[model samples]
Target chain A: MSALFDYTLRLADSALILGHRLSEWIGHAPLLEEELALGNLALDLIGQARALYAYAGAVEGKGRDEDALAYLRDCGQFRNLLLVEQPNGDFAVTIARQLLYSAFAHPFWRDLARSRDATLAAIAAKAEKESAYHLRHAGEWLIRLGDGTAESHRRAQAALDTLWPYVGELFESDAVEEALVNQGIAVDPAALRPEWERSVQAIIAEATLAAPAGTGMQSGGRIGRHSEHLGHLLATMQFLQRAYPGASW
Target chain B: MSAGLRERALAAASGVVDPEIPVLTIADLGVLRAVRLAGDTVEIEITPTYSGCPAMRVIEQELATALRAAGIGKFRIATVLSPAWTTDWLSKEGRRKLAEFGIAPPAGISRRSHFGTDAVACPRCGSAETERISEFGSTACKALYRCRRCAEPFDYFKCH
Candidate 1:
C-alpha cells in the first residue's frame, strides 16, 4: 500500500508541476491560439494529477484528500521527475521540454491503462488519449521550431541538449515500484524506453535536429531530491494552503 | 414509486444543457451515462468530455438544481472514467445542433485528427476545404479551423 501510494504520488506530482509550469504561459503566449492550446494542455495535466492524487488518498486509507496531498506536501517529499520542474525557458525550450516529457508520458499512460489496479487503470485509460494529444502538439512544435530557420534550429537544438540529460531519470527502475510491477499494478519504467526512443528519434529526425549524445544522466527526483527549482515552485504553488491552512474558496 | 422517481430524475438530468455548449443537453452530449434510484436517493453517473473540463462542476450544480426542482431530495453524482468520453458519443441530434450553431461537428474517427491531418468540413459554408488554425479552440474538445472557400473561421468538435 505504501509502495502504491509512493508510485501514484510520483505520477501525480509530475503532472501537477508540469501543468503549473504550462499555466504560467497564460496571458504570455505568442499567439491567441497558442495560449488556448497551452491552457488546454495544462488543464488536462492538472486534471489527471487530481485524479491520481485522489486515488492515492483513497489507497492510503487515510483522511487526506487530494487537496491535502497536493498543497500540503513540502518539496523534499514530492516525487516528480526533475525534468518537469525545470524552468520553462524560451518557446523553443518549452516545446522541447514538453516533447521530451510527453513522448515518454504518452506511452507510459497507454501501458499503464492495462494495470491490475482498477483505479489506476481507469485514470490511465483517460489520460492516454490526453497524452497522445499533448505528444502530438509538442512534436509538431518541435519540428516547426527545429527545422524552420537557422535561429529556430539553433534554439531548438540547444534546448534539446540542455534538457536531454534529465531524460535518463524517467526510465530508472527502483525497488519502490518493483513489487507493483511484478503484481501488474505498476508499469516498469525501464520497459518504456525502447518505444519512447523510437518515437522521439523519428520526431528529431524529421525536425532535422540531431539527437544529443548521452551525457552523465541526472537522477534522484524519484527519491524526492529535486533540482533547486522545485522548492521555489512549491512555495508559489502551495502558498494558499500553507498560508491559510485548510482555506478553501 | 421508486421507479417513477428514477424516471423523473433521469428526465430532469437529461434536460440539463452543457454549460459550455448550450445547444446540447447532457443526454445529447452523452455525458450523462446512467441514472438510477437506490432506495430514496438518486444515483447519477456522468463521464467528462475532457479530463479538465471546468464545466463539469457547473453541470453537477445544475443537475442538483434540476433534481431539486423536480422534487428529488437526495441524489449523488458519480464521475466514471472507463470507456472515456469520445466524439463518437456525441448523438446525431447533438451533431446537428452543433452544426446549426455554427460549429463543425467531428468529421470522423481518425488517429490523424490528433495532428490536424483529417479534413473537417466548414459548418457555415458546407465546404470540405478547411484549414486547421489550431488543434485546440475555445474548449478542450474542439479545434479551430477556417474554410478556404468561405473565408470564415469556425470550431471543429475534434474527434477524441
Candidate 2:
C-alpha cells in the first residue's frame, strides 16, 4: 500500500507541477489559439493530477484529499520529474518540454491503461487519450519550429539541447515503482524508454533537429528533490490555501 | 412514486443543455450517463467530455437547478471515469446540431490523421476539401480547420 501510495504520488506530482508550469502561459502565450491550447492541456494535466492525488490519499488511508495533497505539500515533498519543474523559458522551450514529456507520458499512460490496479488503469485509460493529443500538438509545433526558418530552427534546437539532460530522470526506475511493477500495479519506467525514444527521435528528425549529445543526467525529482523553480511555483499555487485554510468559492 | 420520480429526474437531467455547446443537451452529448431512483432519492452519473473540460461544474449546477425545478427534493450527482468519454458517444442529433451551429462535428478521423490524409467535410459548404490549421482549437475537443472551397475557417470536433 505504501509503495502504491508513493508510486501514485509520483505520477500525481509530475502532472500537477507540469500543469502549473503550463498554466503560467495562460495570458502569456503568443497566439490566442495557442493560448487556449496550452490552457486546455494544463487543465487536462491538473485534472489527472487531481484524480491521482485522490487515489493516493485513499491508498494512504488518511484524511488527505486532493487539495491537501496538492496545496499543503512543501517543495521537497513533491515527487515530479525535474523536467516538469524547469522554467518554461520561451515558446520554443515550452514546446520542447511538452514534446519531451508527452513523448514519454503518451506511451506510459497507454501501457498503464492495462494495469492490474483497476483505479490506475481507469485513470490512465482517460489520460492516455488526452496525452496523445498533447504529443501530437507538441510534435507538430516542434517540427514547424525546427524546420521553419533559420531563427526558429536555432531557438528550437537550443531549447531541445537545454532540456535534453532532464529527460533521463523520467525513465529512472526505483524501488517504490519496482515493487508496484512486480505486483502489476505500476509500470517500469525503464521499459518505456525505447518507445519514448522512437517517437521523440522521429519527431526530432523530422524537425531537422539533432538530438543533444550525451551529458550528465539529472535525477532525484522522484524522491522529492526538485529544481529551485518548484518552490516559487508552489508558493503561488498554494498561496490561497496557505492564507485561508479550507477556503472555497 | 419511485418510478415516477426516476422518470422526472431523467427528464430534467436530459433536458439540461451543455454549458459550452449550448445546442446540445447533456443527453445528446452523452454526458448524462445514468439516472436512478433509490426510494425517494434520485442519483445521477455524468462523465466529462475531456479530462479537463471546464463546463462540468456548470453542468452540475444546472442539473441541481433542473432537479429542483422538477420537484426532485433528494438527489445525488456522481462522476464516473471507468469508461472514458469519447467523441464516438456524441449522438447523431448532437452531431447535426453541431454542424447547424457552424461547428463541424467529429470527422471520425483519429487525431493521428496527418494533415491532409482525412477529409473532414466543412460545415459551411459541406466541402471535403479542408485543411487543418491547428491540431488544438478553441476547445480541447476541437481542432481548427479551413474550408478550401468556402475560404472560411471553422472548428472540427476531432476524434479522441
Candidate 3:
C-alpha cells in the first residue's frame, strides 16, 4: 500500500472506531440532549473518516472506494490510536479518552485544516471545526464529572487516572510523522503536546480535579497496534462487510 | 409532466431541512451528498455529519415524500458510511445561505496550523478581531466564536 493510503487510513480508522464507540451512547447517554450531542460528534468522526478514506482511495487510485476501505478492511489493517478503540468504559473514562484524543486532535486538525495539500487541508479544515466542538463538550463534561457528585467526581478522577496512562500514545511519533511532516502531508503531534497538556491541566484545575500523576506510558496504538478493545470493535463493525461480501445498498 | 417529478422531488428534498439547523435545507447544508437517477429508482446518498443523527431518517423520508409529491418514481436515500461528510463540503454558497438564515458558519481557517493561517474575519462583521469562544459550538459539528468588533456571537462550522 502507498504511504498516502496508510496515512489516510490512520486518520480514517481513528475516527471510525471512535465514532462507533460513541454511537453506543445514542439513547443511553446521561441526558437526552447529551445523547444527541454524542451522536452528532460520532457522525462528525465518521464524516472525517470518510473524507480521509475517500481521498486515500482517490489518491491510491484504488478501485476500493471509501466504503470498501471502511466496511471491508480486516482487523489487523486498522491503524486507529488505542485510546479511540478502548471501550467507552464509565462516563469518566469516556470523558478521559475524549479529552485526551480531542485535545490532541483539536490542534492536529487545526493545523491540518490548513494543509499544504488542498484535499487533505480541506478535509482537515472541516474536521477542525467539529473537533473544536467535541473538545468543548468533553471539557465541560470533564469539569462537571470532576466536580459533580462525590461518586461522579471519584469515578471521573479514577477514569482519568487509568486513561492518563494511554494518553501518551497519541503523541508518540516515528517515521510516519517524519515522512509526512517533512513533506507537509501530516502535522507533527509532538508540537501539539505542550498545548494539549496546558489545556488539559487548566481544565482539570477549573474542574477542581487534580491531574493524575503520570505513570509509565502505554504506547503503540497508532501504528496498527492498539489496546485489547479494538479487536472486538472490528468484529462488530466488520460483520456486515465480511458476512455479505461486496453487498451494496 | 415527467420533468415535473424532478422539480417536485427537489422541492420535497428542499423541505428536508437539517434537524439541528432547521433553517437550512439538506441541500443548503450539502448533506444531500448525492442525488442519482438510477433507472426509475432515484438513489439519493446522504453523508450525515453526526452518527445516528436523528435527522437522517427524517430527511430520507422527507426526500421520498418530496419526490413522491413531484410524482415521478421510487427512490432510496442511502447513507454513505465512508468519506464521511465534512464541513468543507458546506459550500461558500451554503455558508451564505446559513448566514442569511441567521446561523454562522465555521471560520474555515486555512489548512495550515503550524505557524499561522490568516486570521478568520467575522462572518457577521468581517472583523479580523474575532476570537474563538469555544472549539465546540452550539452543535457538535461547529465551533463557537465571537467577534470583539461586532460583539455578536456566531458559530464556525468546524473545519473537519
Candidate 4:
C-alpha cells in the first residue's frame, strides 16, 4: 500500500470512528445544550472524514468513493486510533476522551494545514478551526466537572485515569508518519507532544485534577489493530449501507 | 454561451436564499463563490459557512432549481471547503438583513480558541450589553445570546 494512502486513511478513519462515537450521544447527552453541541461536533468530524476519504479515494485511483471507503472497510482494514474507538463510558469519560484527543488534534491539524499536498492542507486548514473549538469545549467541561461537586470531581478524575494510557499512541511516530513527515506531506506526531502536554496539563491544573501518572503505552491503531470497541462501532455505523446496498437519503 | 447568458445565469443562481436564514440570499451570505458557463452548461461553486451545515444541501438544490427556472440547462453544483467560509465574507447587505430579521450578525473574524469576552450588540435594542447563553446555538452556524438591555434572546450567526 502507498504510504500516502495509508497516512490519509489513518486520518480519515480516526475522524470517522470518533465522529460515530460522538453521534451516539445525540439524544442521550446530559443536557439539551450538550446534545446540540455533541451532535454539531460529531457533524464537523464526519465532514472532515468525508473530505479526507474523498481525497484518499482519489489519490489511490480506486473506483471507491467516500461511502464505499467508509462502509465497506472491515475492522482489520481500519486505521483509526484505539483511543477514538473506545466506548463513551459516562459523561465524564466522554469529556475526558474528547479533551485528550482534541488537545492533540488541534496542533496536529494546525501543522498539517501547511502540508505540501494542497488538498490535505485545505482540509487541515478547515479542520484545524473546528478542532480548536472542540478542544475548547472539552477543556471547559473538564474544568467544570473537575471543579464542581464532589461526585463530579471524583468521576472526572476516574475517567482521566482510565483514559490516560491511550494518550501515548497519539504521539507515536511510525513508519508511515515518518516517511510522510520527511516528504513534507504529514506533520510529525512526536513534535506535537510538548504542546499537547502543556495544554492538557494546564487544563488539568485549572480543573483541580491531578494528571494521571504515566502508564504503559497501548499502541497499534495506525496499523489497523484496534480495541474491541471499533468492531461494535462499525457494526452499527455501517449497518444501513450493508443491509441495503447503495442506499441513499 | 454568450457573456450575457452567463451573467443572467449567475444572477438567477444568486437569488437562491439560504434556507436557514431566509432573510439573506446566498449571494449576500457569501456562500455562492463562483459561476461558470460553457456552451449551454453552467457550473456553480459554493462554500459552506460551517462544515456540517445542513443548509448546504438545501442551498445546492435551490441553486439548481433557480438556474433551471431561468432556462439554464446542464448545471453542476460543487462545494469547495477550502479557505473555509468566514463571516467576513458576509456582505454589508447581509449583515443589515440579519439584524433587521432579529438575528445578530457575527462581530469579528471567527477564531477557534478565542471565545471573545467582547459583548455582542443586541439586534433588538442595539445594546452592546449582550451575554452568550450557549456557545452552540439552535444551528451549527449560530450561538445563542441574550440582550441585557432588551432581554430578548436571539441567534448570532457566529464568526465561523
Candidate 5:
C-alpha cells in the first residue's frame, strides 16, 4: 500500500525471518554459552518483530494486528532479506552470517535511530544497542575461527565466501527507500554503505580474512519476494498460530 | 478498599514472583505496568519478560487470582507490548532480589557496547572476579558466568 506501511512490514519481516532462523540454533550452538546468547538475541529479535508488526497493523488502520501479518501471510508476501532466511549450518557459518548481518546492522540501526519517524526511531534505538552486543559476540567468533586451527580457519573463510553473495542485497536501495527518504522517515541504505564497508573491512582485517569478491546480490525480499528457504521457515514458524486459531490460552 | 480503589488493592500484590526468576515479584520486576480501576472494571497492563515467552499466561492467571482474592472482581489483564520491556524497568529491589537469587544483576542500565569486556562483579563474593563464559545462560534472562575468586558458575541476568 503506502511506503510507510511497506517500510514497516519490511522491518517486521526481517525480524521475523531472522528471529526464526536464530531460534533454530536453540540446541545447536558450538558452545553452551553461545546457545544462550543466540537464543536471548532471538528473543530480542522476536520481540522487535511483534512490536513492529503490531505497529504496522495499527498504522494500516485496517485491523490486521500482529497475528494477521505474521501467520496469515503467504511466502511471497514476506519481505525479509535472503541472508536471514539462510539455514543455520555450522558454528562458523552461523557466526559468519551473524557477523555479516550484525556488522551491517550495528551501523544501519544506529543511524536509523535518528529517523524522523519517532516510533521507528525508538525501536531502532533499542535494537541498535542489542545489535551492537551481538556484533561483538559474532566478531569474537570470527576472529577465533579465522585465526584458529587449519580446518577452523578454512571453514570460517568458506562461510564468509558463501554468505558474501547475500551482502549486496542489504544495501540495495529501492522504491520504499524513495518513499521514506523523500518523507524524511528513512535512511538511504546506500548511504550507509560507505560506513558499513569501513567497519566491516576493519573487522575482516582483524580476523585476517579476505573480503569475498561478489558483483551481484540475491535481492528481492523487501517487495514481498523471497528465497525458497523462506517458505519452509514460514511453515514452521507460523504453524502453531495457523492451527490454533483464536484459542488464546 | 473502596469501590474505586481496585488498583490500590492490586498494588499490594508484591508477592507474585516471575516464574523463571522466582525472587522478584511481578510488581518489583515492573511487569505489572499498570493496575487501573475503571469503575467496576479493572484493567491491568502487563509487560512481558520476553517475546515468545511462555510465562505471560501464567502471569495473567496469577494476576487474576490475586485480584479476586483481594476482593476485586471483573478484572482484565491486558498485555501492553509497547515501549517493549527493558531491564531499565526493573526496580532496584528487583535487582537486589535477583542478586540474592544467585544471579548477577546488570552492571547498570548500559549494555555490552563492545568487546574486550570485563567481568561484572560477582553477587555472592562481591568481588570483581567474574567471567562471562557464554552470553546466554540457563535462560533468555541470564548469561552463564563464573566467579573466579569463588570458582563458581552462576547466571548473570542480562540487561535488557
Candidate 6:
C-alpha cells in the first residue's frame, strides 16, 4: 500500500474504532443528557470514519468501499491507537480516554486543516470543529468528576493514571507519518505533544486533579499489533457483516 | 436539452424534505448541492450537515423518488464532504420556517465559545432570556433550551 493510503487508513481506523467504542454507551449512559452527548460524538466519529474510508478506497484504486473497509477488516488489519481500543472501564475512565484523545485530536486536526492535500485538508477542517466539541465535552466532564465528591475525585484520578501511559503512542512517528509529514500532507504528531500537554495540564489544574507521571509507553497499533481488547471489540463490531455476509438496512 | 433536463431535475429534487426537521426542504437547508445531467443520467450531489446525520440516506432516497417522478429514469446521488456543511448555509427562508415550526434557528455559524454562552432567542416568545438545558437536543444537530420568559422548552438548531 502507498504511504498516502496507509496514512489515510490510520486516520480512518482510529475514528471507526473509537466511534464503535462510544456507540456502546448509547443506551447505557449514566443519564439521558449524557446518552445524547455520547451518541452525538459517536455519530460524528462514525461519519468521519466513513468519509476517510471513502477517500482511502479511492486512493487505493481498490473496489473496497467504506462498508467493505470498515466491516470486513479483521483485528489484525485494524490500525487504531491502543488508547482508543482499550475498554471503557467506567464513566470516569471513558471521560479520561476521551479527554486525552480529543486533546490530541483537536490540535492534530487543526494542523492537518492546513495540509497541502485538498481532500485531507477539507476532512481535517470539518473534523477540527467536531474534535473541539469532543474535547470540550470530555474536559467539562473531567472537571466535574475531579472536583465533585471525594469518591468521584478518587475515581477520576485513578482513571487518569491508568489511561496516561497509553498516550505516548499518539506522538510516536513512524515511516508513513514521516513521509507524509515531509510531503506536507500530514501533521507532525510530535509537534502536537506540547500543545496537548499544556491544554491537558490547564484542565487538570482547574479540576484540582493531579497529573499522572506517565511511564512505560505502549506502541504498535499503527502496525496492527493491538492489545487483547481489540479482538473482542471487532468480534462485536463485525458480527452483522460476518453473519449475514451481505446485509443492508 | 441536458441543461433543461438538469433544471427540471433540480426542481424535482427540491421537494424532498429533511426527515428530522420535516418542515424545511433539503434545498432550504442547503443540503442539496447540485443537480446536473451526465450523459443520459441525472447526477445530484448532497452534503451532510453532521457526519452521522441519519437523514442523509432518507434524503438521498427521497431525492431519487422525486427525480423518478419527474420523468427522469436514470440518476445517481453523490455525497460531497468537501466545503463542509455549516449552519451559515441555511437560507433566510429556512430560518423563518424553522422559527415558525417552534424550533429556534441557529444564531450564527457554530463556533466553539469558551464560555458556552451563546444567546439563543426562544422561538416561542422571541425572548433572549433562554438558557441552554443541554448542549445536545433530541437530535445531533440541535441543542435543548428552555425559555425563561415563556416557560417553554424548545430545540435550537445548533450552528455547525
Mark the regions of model 2 whose C-alpha exceeds 4 Å error after superposition.
Answer: B109-118
Model 1: chain B TM-score vs. truth?
A: 0.95
The TM-score measured for candidate 2 stands at 0.96
Q: Write the per-residue lDDT of candidate 3 for residues B22-138, one digit (tens) a residue.
A: 777787776887765655566778866654345677777777767877674687777764454666677677788776765566555324232122345677787779776555446
Off by over 4 Å in 3: B1-160
Tens digits of lDDT, candidate 6, A1-249? 999999999999999899999999988999998999998999989988998999999999978999999999998899999999989999999999999999999999889989998988988888888888899889989999999999999999999999888999999989999999999998999999999999999988888999998688899899999999999999999999999998998
Model 1 Cα lDDT, one tens digit per residue, B1-160: 9889999999999999999899999999999999998889999999998888999999999999999999999999999998888888889999999999999988886353335466788898899999999988999998999999999999988888
Docking quality tier of model 2: medium
Q: What DockQ does each candidate score versus the true complex, computed on alpha carbons?
A: 0.73, 0.61, 0.15, 0.62, 0.41, 0.65
Poorest stretch of ten by lDDT in candidate 6 chain A: A124-133
Model 6 segments more than 4 A misplaced = B1-3
TM-score of chain B of each: 0.95, 0.93, 0.76, 0.93, 0.89, 0.96
Please report the TM-score between candidate 6 and the true structure: 0.96
* Predicted complex 5: CAPRI docking category: acceptable
Deviation in Å, model 4, residue B126 alpha carbon = 2.2
Model 6 residue A163 CA deviation (Å) reads 0.4
lDDT of 2: 0.90
**Candidate 4 residue-wise lDDT, B6-96, digit = tens:** 8988899889998888999999998999998766678889987766778988998898889889887788889987877888899999999
Proportion of native contacts kept per candidate: 0.75, 0.61, 0.19, 0.47, 0.51, 0.61
Backbone clashes in model 6, listed as residue pairs: none
Q: Give the C-alpha miss distance for residue A212 in model 6, angstroms.
A: 0.5
Worst 10 residues of 3 chain A by lDDT: A219-228
lDDT of 3 by residue, A1-249 (tens): 666667788888898889999988877887655676777788888878877888888888858798888887666778878778878888788887888898889899879865667778767766775677678778888888888999988998888888877778777777867788888888888889899999899889978888888868877755566677877888888788788887877
User: Whole-model lDDT for model 3 versus the true structure?
Assistant: 0.75
Candidate 3 vs candidate 4: the DockQ winner is 4
Model 6 error, position A90 (Å): 1.1
Ranking by DockQ: 1, 6, 4, 2, 5, 3
